[model samples]
Every structure is written in structure tokens, then in C-alpha cells.
Target chain A: MSLEIRNLHARIAANGTEILRGLDLTVEAGKVHAIMGPNGSGKSTLSKVLGGHPDYEVTEGEVLLDGVNILGMEPDVRSRAGLFLAFQYPMEIPGVSNANFLRAALQARLPEGEELEATDYYARLYEKMDMLEMDRKFTARSVNDGFSGGEKKRNEILQMLMLEPRYAILDETDSGLDIDALKIVSHGVNAMRGPERGFLVITHYQRLLDYIVPDVVHVLVGGRIEHTGGKELALELEAKGYDWIKDDIAQAVSA
Target chain B: MNATIEAPIETVSEENDSLMTTGPDFASHPEAFRARQRAAWEKFVSLPMPARTDETWRFADVKSLSIAPYTRAEVVDDGDRAALLKKSIGIVETSGRMVFANDCLLARDIYNDTLRAKGVLWLPMEQAIAEQAELIEKHFMRESGVLGSAKFAALHESQVKAGTFLYVPRGVEIALPVETFHWLSGEGASVFPHTLIIAEENAKVTLVDYFQSAGDDAGFACGVNDIVVGNGARVTYVAVQDWNRKTLAFHLNNTTVARDASALALRLNLGGSRVRDEAVSRLRGPGGRSDMLSVSAAEDDQIFDQRTLQIHEAPNTSSDLLYKNSLNDKARTIFTGLIRVDEGAHKTDAYQKVRNLLLSDEAEANSAPGLEIEADDVRCTHGATSGQVDMEEIFYLQSRGIPLRLAHQLVTFGFLNEVIERLPGEPLQQKLRELLHGKLG
Candidate 1:
């Protein structure tokens, strides 16, 4: 089982600016695949399109999550179908406590007429919060409202752990975290790795890959995966920036 | 120690069908009160209805203010009384509670003995008029109407006969809140409910007023409540207004704060066809503070018009007002608030803020915030914001698997709960949250 995207073409719905053009990749089950790209390389747009954001229209593409096409599905439907996206800039929901927000997300997964057991839900939530070193008061606080940068990132990871989706897309989860926060956040992500789940960890820095080592790394250029290699490619990219990859794509296109 | 006796209250005679007629029951009251009622009724008749050209009636549906279709509410039958009593549950525990249905007292219970031993006067308005005539005469309806509801306030003064009267003596602090439920039932029924609270020096107390209807019937409700906060005293007053969608209503309020005293007044408007609420807070002594807050949800052709004035008459006094409204499905809301600082009232700090969340394209919200400061060194800030719910917030929730409808509700509740959380007590906040949840659901 895997999440396979074939020749995906997308553009901004408002301005018709193409962001994802002829993109392709596969995240197989039991693997952590890292997609490293430069700025404006459609990393965030890819996550948003995969999550079926209304602002982006998929002109041509078929995103199959375990043989089920999710392009036509709504964002919430995609999430409930075992596809999770950890946003780069998590939103602050004023007045809705984090506990209540997470509970609602979990509650939507239940069948009709079946209720989520509150005791069990809280128990699991507290356990995951403990792993992320979150204070008990955060459960009562509004979702990410007035939170520090590091705290918001931790909250995103905490949610990813609680949801436990089959295929998780973490879009720049390491952007705002400090060293201590990075280690803690990486620990939470590493704990979720197993044989049954797949992860598409999108990051620009090699520092994140050093902690949660990727099984495979792909260099993305011009909205497409230009090259694929072992995890060492992350170190190589860090030593020599994305210029080499962009030049390599230029030469290939000229040929 | 003074003892209060149950006095027999005469219901408004049915034969006197017109609301303008002063029936025999009006004559039965004490001469001083009867004189005041006679004068008020005369004033109510002399004053013309609010017109569209009037400044106070701006942005309001003046046509909906007609009271000709409503008459005095008749006493309810046994079945409706039983049902209303059963539904009067607001908070699980209270120091005391009184239930009234259709202007008739259904039940009352006092749960605290220490407060009574300390000379706390908690009685129905009718009984309080009989037992503490001098106290009731001096403080009842003392403030003149100034927030565009003078005619309606005069009408209420002429017709109101039942409500709650609370007095806390000096240095007394009642830990639990006192509650009163006012339920109106039947078609074309009208009820005039009143609440008067007085807290002496260094006293502390909380009171909640519940205005609800027994069923979905077309009716009219005109209510007036006034509070006097003595020196260094603290008072919290909450009014929960939930009438049937087919009913038109008015709630007029006034508060006077003394030196070093603080007052908080919060109103939640959840139901009504067309409702006009006017609240005026006067800080007459130095170091006084008042917090005026309101949250309303208007949907399905409902109209909620709110007018407020914060008058700072003393130096170093402060008043803060915050109002939030959520409108959906052709609903409309109008908010006009003014902060006035009189001459020589230096160092006065006042703030006013109004926020409206429009959920549908057809919904409308109009806001006007004004400031008139005659004193130098006074600080006053006022603003009003009208906008739709943030779409990014909804996307964030949807990314976590929450459905669109639930996401909208969560955001709306969060917007309104910001004011609810400013309240003092936890139990009271919980109860208000439950009521807000029911409305949102």
C-alpha cells in the first residue's frame, strides 16, 4: 500500500498561477520519504492540494491513497480516510480549547449513533501530551492561541500522534522550533514510525533529517521530483545548496 | 429582627382590558407608589412613540415598537405552572431562587440562614413593598430614562407588579448567587418584570435574571432593572433573555455606582422577533468602575437593537463595555454605544468595543461607537468591527477532520465566550456556557 501521485498539475484558483506541474512521487507503506525543495518549489502547495484546500484547483492529477483517489474528496473526507496533514503555520482557534478541538476531530471518525468515550479519549490525549512535554494547562487553553512558536509546532506534532493516520504529510514542521523543541518534536514523530504507516516528511533543512532519518530523499525542482537517492542525499544537499540540482535539471531539459 | 409576611397580591382585573386603564389593583398599592404609577402612566400616554427621525431610534425598526396588540398577562393554569417550575433549573446550587410564570410567583426557596441573620432582604417586589416600604420607595426606579427607552420605561413603571428585590447590608458578603426566573406564556400575553438590587458599603453579591417564554407564542415583554452599588461594594448582575421567535420585547436597565465600588452587568440575548435593549451606567463617585458586556445570537428574521451609555461623572472612575453579536439567515443587529466624560472628571478611563460576525450574505450588522469627552487627561477609546468568520480558521479545523458546520459553531462560540469568560464566578460561567451551547446547537 502506498500514496501515489501521477503527473499532478495544479494552479491557484484565484490567479491561475501554476504551482504544481507534472509532479510525481510515491510514499510506500513502512517508509519515511523526505521531499526537500527550495522556496516557492510548491512544497506547501502540494500539501494543501493533497488536503483538498479550496484555494487550489487540481487541473490534472490522480492522488491515490491505497488505491482510492482522493482528488475529488473534501478536506475533511480526506482526513477521515486516513490522510493527515500537519500544517506549516498552524492556526490559532480562539475560544476553542485544544482538548475540545482534538475531541471533535476524533469524534467525527465514529460511526453514527456511537459516542466517543470521554475517559478513554482524555487518557490517550494526556499520554500523547506527556510525550511532547506539554503542560496540562494547554489542554484547557485555546488551540494555539497566544502560543509561542515552539509551542505551536509541538501542538501540531501532538495532534499528528493522536490522529495516527495511515499516511501523514508533515509540511515544514521544523521551521520554528529551537534545538530543544526540535528534539522533542522529532521524538514524537519518530515514535509514530512503524511497519504499517507511511510518512511524507517535507522539509527544507537537513537538520530535521539528521534526527528522524529518512528512508529515501528526493530533490524537488520546478514542481517535480528531479532526483532520488539514499538518506545521504540530505547531507549532500546541505553541503551544496539546491543550485546544483536546479542546474542539473536545466542541462537535462536542454538535452 | 424583622419578619416578612406573605401578602396577598391582586392580579390585574380582566374586565379592565385596556393596558392604559389603572385597575383596582393599581389603587390597592400604597399611596406613594400609586401616585408614582399614576404620574408614570400619564407620562407614558403623553409621550409619542419613537419615530425614525429621532436620533435614538436610528438604525432601529421603529414599526416593531408598537404595544397596542398586547395586554396584561393573565395568571397561568396549573399545568403550565408545573411545567415552568420544572424547567426553572438554572444552576444546581444557589443561595435563594424565586420562580414567576405569567407575572405570578410559582415557588421560592431561601437556602442560606447566615445571610438572613445579617439582615439581608430577599423578597418578591410585592412583599418587599409591604415589608420594607421606605426602602423600596427610596430606591425603586430612581434613575430617569435616558437611553431612548423613556416611553417604555414609563410604561413598565406603570404596569410592573412582580419581580425580585435584594438588599445586602454593610460588610456582608453572600457567597452564592441569588436567581429569579421570569417566564411568559400564552398568545398576545405581555409581562412587565422588574429587578432592583442594593448593596451597601463593602457588600458583595450576585444576582441572575432569567427571562424566558413557556412556549412558542406571540407575546410582548417589557422589563426594567436598576442597581445601586454603595461605597466599596461589588455587584454582578446577569440577565438571560430568551423569548419565543414570534415575540417582541424591551429590556431597560440603569446602574449607579458609588465611591470605590465596582459593578458588572452582562446580558445574553438568544431569542426574540425584535428586541430593543438599553443600558445606562452612571459612575457618580470617584474610584468607581463598571463593566458592561453583552453577547447576542440573532437568526431567522430576528432583530436585536442595543443602545448603551457610560457616563463618568467622577474623577478616576472607569467603565468598559464589550458587545459581540452573531447573525445568520437574514437576521439584523444594531449597536450604538457612547462613552461620556463630564467636565472636571479628569483621569477617567473608558473603553467601548463591538464585534459582529455575519454568517450569511443576507445578514446585516450596523455599529456606531461614539465618544464625548469634556475633560482633559481623560482616556477614552471606542471601535466597532463587522466581518465574516475567518476562512483560514475553518480550514484549520477541517484539516483536523472536523466537519464544516461544527467548525463554524466552534469559532462562533469562541468569539462569544471571550465575553462570557470575563465573568467572575465559575459556576455562573458554566451555566452561561450551557445556555450558549443550547442556542448554538
Candidate 2:
């Protein structure tokens, strides 16, 4: 089974400017796929569209998680259907404690009238927080309010660990992270990897690949996938930049 | 079972007999107190109801200010009293507590003996008037409180019977907060509750007043509280007003701070069909400070009209006021506040901020913040803002699987918590948070 997107086309709902143009990708359940792209290549927009953000309209596309289409579902419904997106810029929910926020999110997954056991919930939360090296006080603090850049990213990973979605998308999770924070965040994501889950790591540079190495790397340019290779492709792009691939795509289009 | 057992027979007008339950202790009260009550009743009758044309009643639902259909509270039955006593459990660790139902005292528990021995006096208003008449008279409703509720204030003074009277002597500090609960129980019944706090120089104390209804009954509540802070004293006061949705209520407060003394007052308005709240703080001494805070979670057709005034009467004094409101359904809220720096009160610092989070498109919020400055080099800032919950914030929660309704509530709670967190003491904060959660949910 795999998470697959086929011939996806989307546009900005406000201005009708197309962002995703016939994008196609597949992430096998047991593999980690990385999408490396230049600026304005629809990296973040793809994640938002996949999450069912209202700002973007899918003109034509079908997203299948384990052979069931989720394109018609609401954002929250998509999440309950096993799709999770790690936002590039996590929102700051003032006055909502991280513990309560995570609890509510987890509680939403339960069947009606089924109460979440508080003792076990806190136990699992503490364990996951410890794995992330998060201080105990973070749970009591407002969700992402006044959090440092690295701390917010770590909080995103912390939530991913708790929710444990079937198909997870990391949308530029490496931006604004220092070297040390990068390693810690990578560790958290790495700990979640297994044969039952799939990951789509979207990023601009290849530095993140060094820690969470990908099984396959795809070059996305002009809102379309232009090249596909193994993990070494990330190193080559980092050394050569995106110009070489853009030139190749230009020549291919002309030919 | 005459509800007006304490009302004097001679002074009870036919109209008032149907409208008010005077305290049972009124006949035995000192002549001076009785005379003042009689005069207040006359004043209440003479004063006209606030009209929409009145500046103080601007944007208010003046039609709903009718108290003619409500009568004074009657004595609750034993069973009702027991239930209310059980529900009166608030903060776990209070130094003293007094529970009242239908203007009658049900339970009085003072847990700390050391405080009792330290010349700390906490007694019912009637008992305090009997035992400390001069002391109660000195600070009882000293301010006219002319913030659009003068008629209600007069009505409260005319029929008020039982409340909390706290007197903290100089050099005595109560380590724990004192608590009082006023519960109104009856259909079409009304209650006049009063609280007078006097903190002596160099003393410290905290007090919490809870105005709750025993049930969801349409009633009327007119209450008043006056706080006097002496020099070098610290006082924190919080009033949690959770009357039922069918109730019409008025809560008026006047606080005076002396040199080097600081006072903090927080009001949480959760329930009421129509609630008018007026708060005034006067910094009468240099180096004094006052923090005025309020949080209201109004829903359905509830209306919360709050007016406030901060008077900087002395140089170097400071006052900060923050009021937050969250409205849902067709609920409405109005906030009007003024910070006035009196002449010769140089170096005064004052701030006023009001924030409204409208959760529904039909919900409405109106705000007016003003400053009247007569002194030079004084710092004053006032602002009011109305905004809906951020869609991005909602999306963030939904992306994590939280349903839309639940996500909206969590964000609203967070918006109001900014004011709740400013109060000191964790246990109290936890209790307030729990109460807020229940109301929002």
C-alpha cells in the first residue's frame, strides 16, 4: 500500500493563479521520499493542498491513502483518515497549553463516548516529550506561543510522534533550525520511522537529508517533477544548485 | 413563610412589599443605619431608570433593566440550603468562607485560627454592623458609584441585608484568601448582596466573592462592593459572577488605594441574561498601584455591559486595566473605560486595554476607551480591539484532528486566559480555569 497523488492541478482560490500543475508522486508505506525544489516550485502549496487548506482549490486531482481517496474530505477529516501535515510555520495558539492541545487532538481520534484515560495519556505524552528532550514545562506552556524557532519545530515533531499518522508530510521542517536543533528534530522524526508508516520530506536544501536520509529524491521544478534519483541526487543538487536541472528541463522542453 | 421577615412593617410600601425582601435584622439595626436605609429607599424611588439617551447607558439594552417583576429573596428551604452549601466548594484552601443563600447565611467556616487571633475580623454584614457599626459605616459604599447604575446602587443600599464584612488590622497579614458565596434561589426573586473590605496600613490579604445562582431561574441581583486599601498594604480581590442565564444582574465596585498600597481586582462574567458591571479605582496616594482585570465568556443572547474608570489622584501612582471578552451565538458585549489623570498628579502612569473575540458572525462587540489628562508628563494609553478567531489558528488545530467546534472553544479559552494568568496564586488560577472550562464547554 502507498500514499499516491495523481495528475493533481490546483490554483489559489483568491487569485486563481495555479500553483500545482499536474503533480504526480507516490510514497510507499515502507519508504521515505524527499522532494527537493527551488523557490516557488509548489513545495509548501502541495502540503497545504494535501491538508485540504481552504485557500487552495483542487481543480482536478485525487489523493489516495491506502487506496481511499481523501481529496473530498475536510482538513480534520483528512487527518482522522491518517494524513498529517507538519506545517512549515506552526501556528501559535495563545493560552492553550501544549498538553491540553495534544490531548484534545488525540481525544478527537477516539470513538464517541470513549473517554481518553488521563493517566495513560499523560504517561505517553511525557515519554514522547522526553524522547524529544523537551523540558517538562513545555507541556504546561501555551502551544507554540513565544516558542523559539527551533522549539516550535520540535513541538511539531512532538505532535507527529503522538498522533502517529499513516502518511506524514514534513513541509520544510528544516528551515530556521540550527545545527544542534536540526539533529534533535531529526532524531524525533527518525524515531517514528517504521514499516507501517510513510514519510514525504519536503525541503529546499539537502542539509536535512544528511540526518534523515531519504530512500528516493525527486527534483521538483516549475510545479512539476523533472528528475528522480537515489539519495545521491540531493548531494549533487546541493553542490550544483538548481540551475543545472532548470537548464536540462529547458532544453528538454525545446527538443 | 413571609419572605420579607426582616423588612420593617411601617416603611414597607405596598409596591415595595411585592418587590423586596428587606433583611430580617433591619428592625433591630441602629437608628442611624435604619434612617440611611429609609433615605436610600426614597432616593431609589426618585431616581429615574437609566434611559438610552443617557451617556452612561449608551449601547446598553435599557429595556431589559426592569426589576419591577422581581421581589427580594426569600429564605431558602433546608434541602435547598444543603444543596447550595455542597455546591459552595470553591478554592480548596481559603482562610475563611461564608455561604449565603437568598440573603441568608448558611455556613460560616474560618479554617485558620491564627488569623482569627491576629485581630482579623470577618463577619456577616448584619453582625458586623451590630459589633462594629462605626467601622462598617466609615467605608460602606463611600463612593456614589455614578457609573450608570446609581438607581440600582440605591436599590441595593435600600434592601441589602447580608454580606461579608472583612477588616484586616495593621501589621496583620492573612496568608490565605477569604471567600464568600452569594447564591440566589427562586423564580422572580431578587437579592441585594454587599461586600466591604478594609485593609489597614501595612496589612496584606486576598478575598474572593462568588455570585452564583442555585438554579437557572429568572431573577434580579443588585450587588455592591467597596474596598479600602491603607498605606503599604497589598490586597487582591476577585469576583466570579456566574448567575444563571435568565438572571438580570448588576455588580458595582469602588476601590481606593493609599500610598505604597497595591490592589488587584478581577471579575469573571460567565452567565446572565443581562449584566451591567461598573468598576472604579482611585489612587489617592503616591506610589500606589491598581490592576483591574475582567474576563467574560458571554454566549447565546447574554449581554455584558462593563464600564470602568481609573482616577489618578496622586502623583507617581499607576493603574492598569485589561478586559477581555469572547462572544458566541448572538451574544453582545459593550466596554467603555476612561483613565483620568487629575491636575498636579504628575508622573502618573495608566493603561487601559479591552479585547473582544467574536466567535460567531452574529455576535457583536462595542468598545469605547478614553483618556482625560490634566497633568503634564503623565503617561496614558488606551485601546480597544475586536477580532475573530484566526482562521490559520483554526486550521492548525484541525490539521491535528481536532473538530471545528472544539477547536473554536480551545482558542477562546486561550484568548481569555491571558487575563486570568495575570492573577497571583496557582490554586486560585486553577480553580478559575476549571470554572471557565465548564462554561466554555
Which pairs clash inside model 1? Answer: none
Worst 10 residues of 1 chain B by lDDT: B1-10
Best by DockQ: 2
Clashes of each: 0, 1
DockQ of each: 0.86, 0.87
Clashes by residue pair, model 2 = B6-B24
Compose the digit string of candidate 2's lDDT tens values, residues B98-177: 99998889999989874595688888887886788889678988775578888888878877778999899998889888
Interface RMSD values for all candidates: 0.7, 0.6
What would you estimate as the lDDT of candidate 2? 0.91
Off by over 4 Å in 2: B1-17, B20-25
Return the lDDT, model 2, position B435: 91
List runs of model 1 lying over 4 Å from the truth. B1-17, B21-24
lDDT of 1 by residue, B1-441 (tens): 012212223434332235643232463357678678767876777777898788998999998877767767777989888889899988787888899987778998888764574688888887776678788878888875688888888888877778999999999998888999999998888888899999999999999999999998889998999899999999999999999898899999999999999999999999889999999999999999999999999899999999999999999999999999999999999999899999999999999999999999999999999999999999999999999999899999988888899889999998998899899987998899899989997
